[model samples]
Target: MAHDHGHDHASSTRTRLAIAFAIIAVVLVVEVFGAWLSGSLALLADAGHMASDAIGLLVALVASVWATRPATDRHTFGFRRLEVLAALFNGVLLTVVAVVVAIEAVRRLTEADPHAPDGIPMLVVAGIGLLANVAAYLVLRGGDRRSMNMRGATLEVLGDLFGSIAAVVAGVVLLTTGFAAADAIASLVIAALIVPRAALLLRDVVRVLTESAPRETDVTLIREHLLETPEVVAVHDVHVWAITSGAPVFSAHVECEEAVFAEGRAGSMLERLGECLRGHFDVEHSTFQLEPAGHSEREEPAHR
Candidate 1:
């Protein structure tokens, strides 16, 4: 029942992403035409943001499909990591887009010619775009943050929501004051707002793909917990990393005291230790080996 429920949830998420992608695509087309007609950079900037959102949604859809492929002998973990990779790519793409926006704003501000169009029409269009973005954001609100694929999409939605609001504000200000430069200035603000969030997502996804320890996991703390187990004497060569977003895998070497070895229950002791680790840390996958104090020097580091 639990497995079936999980499958159903995954299916629902895919359906939502598909719908959002369609909506964003339609909005992008409308905004592009609107910006062209009104000559409003703010509207154009929002359109560009919608384009990125479309790309992010597409990447998420592909990742979800790939994640369902059955595991094979050559790749035991199947294709789950592909989703994280896609998210990293999306983050990088967003960062680049932000940089371009910043550069364009600098040029316009220096030139002192914003080329602002009549503000009333731009304001109306921007307001509509903002409404669309808010709807899209709500659609993705139920996604699990632990899934980097879902998290990345959520971040993109948030960026679009903020971008739309900025464009609407700029349009309104320009319409009231004819401050043509307000549009360019809003573009710069939107760009700056997007950079840090995108960069943070990129950094986290890269760390997971590289097999670096998850930020929330402490190797020392994990080792200490193992050492405190009744029969364990020495613990070493511990490693921990994220299997995907929320799932974590841990492996380690432990030495049992001579007294415990005398009981001839090293295997059972190791089993209890595994349970303890899981119970304490919410770790789902573990590989632990037991050894007599000096039995067979510890092996080489485990490959990620």
Candidate 2:
């Protein structure tokens, strides 16, 4: 029963990630071609946004696969952290793309005779991108929001949606007022939107790599909860982090009322505690040290 449930969950996640990547890649290709045909900076900006979305979705998909790879003697934790690294890399690349786009847009506004032939193509491409983004967002919406990897994919879709809207508005302005400069202005606005989101994602990915606490969990609160149990005396060396994106893992040393000989009861209680973590807090991996009152301090603790 438990085995089938776990397999089904993993399969569902994999299928969703794959679909999102497919949508992003297809829409991005269309936007790129549309931008070339229209010569509209706003359409190009949407293309750039979609290009980054494709990369983000690819990273998320690859991470999902890597996360399931079996652990080996050479790599104890498997490849789960690759997801965090991929997210960080995606953020950096997106930030760079945004900066380059902004600078180019500004330069074109000053030097080039920036003129768009017609607003129709821009409007059409933007509309398609908007629809694709919304559909992708719907697919990823049910996953764990605290998963930085998943959050990266979600933000990419959202960025594409915003970029599409900006393109549509620029098209409208060009059609009505002959203000081709609106296209350039829209590009800059899209770049500005990308900057903050990329920076925030980069910060979160960095925190995870540095083994900082997971953003959604509080170590102190977890310790307090453990201490509330009758047999627990104190909790120390408590560490908490995510295994992949949605699966949090924790390790800690808990002082107990009895000696080390009381392993049976302690083990059962810890098992129950693990179940509670999975049910309530979405923690998938847990390792706890059963220590006598002062036994933890007497010797070096084991690392699981």
Candidate 3:
């Protein structure tokens, strides 16, 4: 629960995401029109992919807004988890997009279609798309990349940007040399580039959804740091996890010598422990139970 996100940062992210969504939507409409005018199935397919990116951006925008809601009784963590889910959804979408592009590239390589789209129009439309994708990518690039939602949205925009580049390359080759295979080759290359990044994003998303500790935290190291404090006899039941990206939570039970408790030094120990977590581990939300040594031995077993 060490959520360091301030209202200003959240507000900024939401504004940029909204701008990206708007840019992508405008590009999608333009692509659809270009697809109709040229009757190029390739342009139409690209438009479909752009539409998917728009959806992904929209999802990220909505999730960001929801994550800002105040905590409730039923959901004390609020809706921050939605950002992780949106990121997972966007990751899956990116994988599907890469697979689809690969399959289409193979299709074009294996079979020749007689549509014979006008390369001039294709080039013009792709140029516009390339510019639009660039704008959207830059807007999202300003947001928090560590945030799963923002990262996912940024990846989608980046994928669209790659598509626009591939299209531009294909259009140039087709118009200049009438080499149709250029389109398929460009698509294959783009797909190859997208897969690795998509895999990395999905892996990060899975880490959060599975309740894994933040990558930066070292539980063993944290325990040793706690032990270094004076009068701390032992520590146990240590737990660490994240509510979302950049927000780590920690908890443990600290056993002190009986004299330390008798002297009523629990408050000072707790303050020192809290500072340790904040200063060393970058954890702001933590819970600790102060107990005398050997206290845990008298506790009942779980569910017994």
lDDT of 1: 0.83
- TM-score attained by model 3: 0.90
Number of backbone clashes in candidate 2:
0
In the range 251-294, model 3's lDDT, one tens digit per residue, is 89888988877888888889999999999988989999998888
Local error of candidate 3 at residue 295 (angstroms): 3.5
Relative to the true structure, candidate 2 has a C-alpha RMSD (angstroms) of 3.3
| Model 3 root-mean-square deviation | 3.0
Model 1 residue 288 distance off true place after TM-score fit, in angstroms:
0.8
Report the lDDT of model 3 for residue 63.
96
Worst 10 residues of 3 by lDDT: 295-304
Candidate 2 per-residue lDDT, tens place, 1-304, comes to 9978866765777687788889988888998888888887877877888888888778888887787687899988898788788798789878987998899789878966776536888878878888998998889877657557788888878877888888888888888888878888989988998998999999888777777777879777777877777777778888897655565789887778774345568777687668766776677789887777876666665432
Can you list the residue pairs that collide in candidate 1?
none
Ranking under TM-score, best-scoring first? 1, 3, 2
Worst ten in a row by lDDT for model 1? 295-304
At residue 101, give the lDDT of candidate 1: 86
